[model samples]
Target: MLSLRRILTVSATLGILLFLSFFLEQRLQAVAFRVVMLSGIAVVMAVSLNLINGFTGQFSIGHAGFQAVGAYAAAALTVYGHNRIFGNLPRSGQLPDTLQGFLLGAPAMICALLAGGLFAAVVGYVVGLPSLRLKGDYLAIVTLGFGEIIRVAVENTEAVGGPRGFTGNIREGIYIPNLTSFFWVYLMVVVVVVVSRNLRFSVQGLQYLSVREDEIAAQAMGVNTTRVKVNAFVLGAFFAGVAGALYAHFEQSVSPTSFGFVRSFDFVTMVVLGGLGSITGSVLAAVVLTALPEILRSSLGAEFNQYRLVAYALLLILLMLVRPQGIFGRGELRLDRLFGRKGGGGPAGRDNVEDQPAATELR
Candidate 1:
């Protein structure tokens, strides 16, 4: 059952945010809203990717591949569906009830997300089947190749506009009047974070950790390492797909280059910098990393834009020098730890003191 009190609390908070977003003429509101959206997306991407990279210790740089699949799948359904049903793409200004009903119904968005996730999972299975046999750098190379292949495939696919890209009306021209509001994005992010937290504490998540720890030993202990690893891979792909769908709709554009190796590196950098297995760390790092680049670009302008990359490079070097294990290392950062679950390994069931490989293990 939904908690009425919690719902009301959230609603009230969101109402305030919406007012600030709409009413305030200050540029700060725009920046804040963008930050919130970016943070939400980052949380989704980081947490889901964590399932494979952090919990399962998989070396998958194909994160963006799944995202691309989801983005196109969702964008195509809405854009094509509207054109087919209405005989023309709904323009932004106004729309008839037929299109409005179709677009405004939250159910369509949910369906699109499901389609995206399922498609990405299918791709995950196909990719994982061949690549899982490899190890370490070999696995990373295979996943990297997979990402490039996805980009190439997207670039050549005329249905989605190939390299030219695709853009059309989203929301069926309903002028839905603030459908992508703060509350919606915030709720999605919160749900994702909570679900990830619960999954990390579940039996399957423990199995993922077992695989990460030692595949041979995990297999000896009756864990189906292959299934466990694939579960992480597919599940992570699903969330990545979801995030991509959200981003596509938010930006109202779809491009193959948008979901390429550089995007994958951004995600990996967030996970590695935060603490591979630490959910809290991932969320924090994602928010910081995503915003930092934009902030630098804004403040420094084109003249200093290149320095932003240098800054990140220097930060990476410093992180390696100071603590190669990462800020959290194998340690998790859950509120539960402060209370009593310390060393319990919230989801993975490993001893907190156990030595685990560094994020460099993926590289």
Candidate 2:
């Protein structure tokens, strides 16, 4: 049974997210809206990757591969099923912002997203099989290879437009409706964060941490390291797939080039920069990194924008040199901790006690 405090916390979180979604959709400029959506997507990706790389101490880097699979899978479903399921209904972008419109569109959108996530999870399981025998750089290499293989495979698959892209042809009665919104994106954000936080404090999470600390030792202690690592990959890929589905629907298109190794590297950077095994750090890093480039473009104008990458690289180097464990290290930022008050008794207090050793070592 859930406690009253937990219920209230959940209610408050949903209420705040609901208000922000409506407010930001109505008030933000187009550029800001795009940035916000992209930031939410980044948060999802980073947090999922943190489970595998940060908590499980796995160095798999083929996240973009899973995302690509999800994008194409979800896009295919939405485009092909549009006429059959929706029956000449207006695209989500064209729908009026009324409760009726939401009711009409939500079912199809939810189905597509779930299909994408499930397909990606299956692929993740296949990819994770190699992890049973490989570790560290070897596993990273295998995952990197898988990412490239996926890209090449997609590039050759003419059904998804091959190297061109997957933009549905309206004349052919195939169209990817714009079904993504601030509400959907941030709702997933809240769910992923809450899930990650709960997992981080649970008994299973202890198995993950032990694997990260020492796989052999963890195995000796009766933990099924292989299963834990594979579970991490599957869960991480599921969330990445959902994020990709959101991206596909929001952009109403996807290309093979978009989900390449470079994209995977960017997610890796976000995880490492935020601090391994830190959910709050991942969220903060995702938002900052997603917004930073746009901030540069707007502030520096077109001419100086060419040097933005240089500035970005320098900043990362400086941060790593100064605080290699990342901005928040492995601990979360708590209001009580900030106020210099002892954490009140509960699961939250227990989590603080449990996580301290890891954080201290990093410091």
Candidate 3:
């Protein structure tokens, strides 16, 4: 079993290589590095959403709203700063001559990412406060509505280009550097998975499960259900926002369409297909889902466009029928249990199970 410290060290080393690959002058190396960065972004999204949808047992469809906040926040800052420096957003395929210089020279870009995350957290707080009152489909509906509200709000906001959307010639931040590589993204994904897996085993994570299982029982046991729920939602939103920021810069564009309700549903589908409470499942689902479309696009070219979604829907339906609990259910899918830390010990540990009462003497 790799200790947490050792795992982190390995991740850091890989990240360094990915970051440096951007300047390697090798096209293959650069493309590989960018793929890693994207994988990392996906990891961030999957892990964060796992907290609320998996651990906390909440059915939220507002994950994309947080991502939007992050993307716009990062994109806006990049554009504004680029305008300040180069007089406009850079055009496609252009590289900044200063790439070899200090990494993270654009400090505002990092700030934008952080700000986007914070803004998403704030939104989480507001939406979670009320929606937490409901359960099951009711809760899902409320969150779905929240997601639509965010999309419409962004569409109406003129400051950010409103409905038409905004595109900026922005560069990736140096903290990561254009050195964005596959290994970097893959490493980051590994980090998110590791962190999330650890959290699921921690004591606080147990509390989350308790709440997820039975609010009344958890409250009886002195667990603060409200706090647990809010924390899950907010923290998940924070990471989603960060992923959004990374995505915005990676794509160098921001639009309301990118964060529509369908996007939120996609994340939910990943969580569901992966298993409602399995970290390993989430990771697997994210990779499969993210790559599926790209694979189809590559293989079928433009002709496969309409069938892509049809395939997605069919896949979802098939999964539900074959494995209603998802690929992992409340369990994780790890090859070596000995190498990993023990999680919360299955669904039975949750507080939701009811005890049968003894028969009365009179009866």
Candidate 4:
């Protein structure tokens, strides 16, 4: 079903990601690489959350709960199935560079990621069924409770190490192979961004936007608001789960404390700091927020790193005060817009004018 342009775009993206991953793996410092990978994960989280909070106008805040489900599910699979699936393959700190190891390991990793995502999507559906009927603060409360419940449940579950955390022990033959790499992380980033951008322009996405703009009116217009909201939740949760899988594999560990309300709030902050409905804004915010802490730590001594939160809080406060609607105010960044060409007053111009009312409402 894929078109020629779509296939070409995907092929070119993969080629670029492959080259960059190899080059960066060889040249980037360890800390820099970690930051970059974390940023990619953040990008996934922020963009996915935007689909719900921005596009769908749902204020669910328990994104970390879905992320937790994915992380543990993927980690458990990789840890328990490593020996059976990978055989005598030796565990390494990074992905296997050799062709044989890649052949043996890549499929399992892909399956694990898909399983995690699907599991999270199921959970999202369950949560969305009752909760999406509520709006604004009520929905947020339900979601916040959901996240807390996940953390508490994880704390009590012994099979996953409970409070101790899941660090796959090599001696016990349990291992979570380091399968996450720049190629995978950025690949997901690109996928999420592209899908989000396309959805924004699609008919289904218009239904989502309508619900966000006015639920009652959207329903009157024959939009199945509940279905749209649930779809958004599921899609968002799926991507968050994949991102969580990547995080678990990259960090080589999972803990109950990692996916907490604080983490969910962080994603919300990124969405708010960026424009609510702007994909590029979310990406930019994710990168900035992810890297800011590392930059602070490197510039300020380790002893002074504790104060970084104070600076982060202050920055957010200032930004909110200055531009409460966010950087782009529901509009996306475009090269043509930047250069003031206005699509040469052609079909693109007409499209822009047609879209202006919705854009104004969204803002």
Candidate 5:
């Protein structure tokens, strides 16, 4: 049974979103709309990676492979499944209804996104199984290999347009609004942030932190370290998959080349920019990094776009030199920070502490 308060909250949020989406859809130009949507996707990816690399202390970087998995799966479902199930592509006459309905005339893009996320989670479990045995650079390299393998494998599979790309053809003339609309994208962003925050503050979340601090110690304390690690990977991949689905539907296509090493690196950069273990930081970094290039391109001209990467490298270097922990340094920018609340990694905080042997300090 749902409480009235809960019901009202959901209702109010939906109303606000409808208003927001409708208003913005009317006013914004295509480019601004695209940037906002892409920022939402970046938020999902960055937050997901933070769970694995930041909170869990793993350095795996094959994030793009998971994204690809979701993108292709969702695209295939939309493209091939439509033909098989409906026997014809969607018609524009019913497009508004189709888009608004949960039904998959093309399968509501949400369905594809969910399907993609589920598939990616399963694959994450499989990949994470072997990954649990590795550590440090070895783990990073292995994950990188996994990503490369996924790209090559997909490159060969002709069904999803293989190297050519999944065009997401809908019988030409069928108008499919980009599924990464402000409402859907922001809704996922909220869900991702809420879920990640809840997990970080929960009992299982504690186990994740313990494992990150010391695997041997965590095992000694009876925490199922393996379970925690695998759980992290699965959840991370699931979100990444959702992001991929959004990416595909937004672009109206999918290709192996999009989710390559550079894409993976871009995600890594987000995680690093936003302090590790800091959800707030990740969100901020995602928005900034994603919008920066586009802003530069529109304002300073396309030629200045080349300087984006250079700026990133320079900013990253300066950050490392001045504040290696990142903008927040394993902390978060909260309202309290503005109000002068100083926090420490005491029993209440998460920072590792040292213990001196009793009675030996004087020596």
Candidate 6:
């Protein structure tokens, strides 16, 4: 558990880091910038999904559906709003780099992102209501079906460019311009991680864990397992939606295919590959998986690129065989556990002396 002061310090430090990211983005190369932004989005998705699939032990495969909803919502709002507001003005990304641009561009984009999150949260509640009651493969089926349904619905909707997908170039403020994305992306990553961590330590979070450990036991103990499950889904989906918005804004376009069933599995892979119930592991896995393909293609050339996904699948298979609990297992990396290897026992913990009566008596 972190103390209030320590937590606040961490929050402030992250805020400072966000400020520094904007300051440093101007210096980072294009590829590096792209990686950072994409990694941030990955972190958002992986950590948020981990809350549902990892901590809550729910099998949700429709996360991409919520993301699509958010993506299209934000994109439509931005593309249309920008057109209606400024018509032919220069895009927000092209605005002055001075304080004025920061004030205007940052706030408008933040509102759009938050708006996207709000829309997703409402939809998450609706989807979670009926679906969270089920468990195991049934739940997965429901989520998968939900995702496909969203895709089909979007494809048929002529308002958002139909099957061709919604493509737009912003000529003014309404979306997050690519230029300021690193700041927004990493900031949200920090937010997701912090919220997940905090929730896991809260009373409600314990109920979530209890439900994961045993739903019947949790229910018997008076914990509302259904409530916990729905909360997990809604919270996780909100972050996923925010990730979608950031992604859509960065790419400056989105399609039904962008957030398909396969994309949902990519997130699941990140969570399962990372240690479930381990926030740090999720973040690390997100960064590695997000960057692995690019690294391979650049370093190993074109032929290897085609087999990259195969390599990823193989690596996951090997990890399951070798370390089924993932790189870190159920526990997390804590500062207290870093300095020394302490024996598992009482008060300050005792030395490991299973066969030494005298050693046990001494401590």
TM-score of each: 0.79, 0.90, 0.78, 0.91, 0.86, 0.84
> In what order do the candidates fall by TM-score, top score first?
4, 2, 5, 6, 1, 3
Which tens-of-lDDT digit does each residue in 1-363 have in candidate 2?
999999999899777876776688789998889999999988999999999998888897888898898889988887777778766556443555555655666886798789889999999999897664698899999999999999999899888889998887555756677778787888889888988999887788877888888777777777778888999899999999999898998898999999998789778878888899899889999899888876766777896657755665776799889998888888788767789988545665554644532221110
Cα lDDT over the full model 3: 0.69
lDDT of each: 0.71, 0.82, 0.69, 0.84, 0.78, 0.77
Clash totals for all candidate models:
1, 0, 7, 0, 2, 1
lDDT-better candidate, 4 vs 5:
4
Higher-lDDT candidate of 2 and 3: 2
Q: Of 1 and 4, which scores higher on lDDT? A: 4
Model 4 / residue 17 / CA error / Å: 0.7
Q: Per-residue lDDT of 1-363 in model 6, one digit per residue for the tens?
A: 999999999889767876776676678887777787888898999998999998878998878898888888877766676656434324543555554655556655675688678888898899899999999999999999989999999999987767987765423334335424566787888789889877776667777777787788777777778888999998998898898888887887789998897788878878888888778789988899888765666678999757766777898899999999888666566655687765455654222211111111110
Off by over 4 Å in 1: 1-28, 83-89, 93-105, 169-180, 303-305, 334-363
- As for candidate 4, its clashing pairs are none
Per residue, candidate 3 scores C-alpha lDDT tens digits across 151-241 of: 8987998766789776643244212123223433444466667767776666677778777777787777777788889988988988888
Which 10 successive residues of model 1 have the least lDDT summed? Answer: 354-363
Task: Answer with 1 or 4, whichever has the higher TM-score.
Answer: 4
Model 5, which residues run further than 4 Å from truth? 84-107, 169-177, 299-307, 339-363
RMSD over all Cα atoms, model 1: 6.2
Among all candidates shown, the one with the greatest lDDT: 4
Off by over 4 Å in 6: 1-15, 83-93, 96-99, 169-180, 298-305, 339-363
For 125-226, candidate 1 gives per-residue lDDT tens digits of: 888877777778898998899889989988998877789776754334432112243434555566667776776656676677767878887777777677
Candidate 3: the clashing residue pairs are 32-182, 33-181, 33-182, 34-181, 36-182, 36-185, 104-174
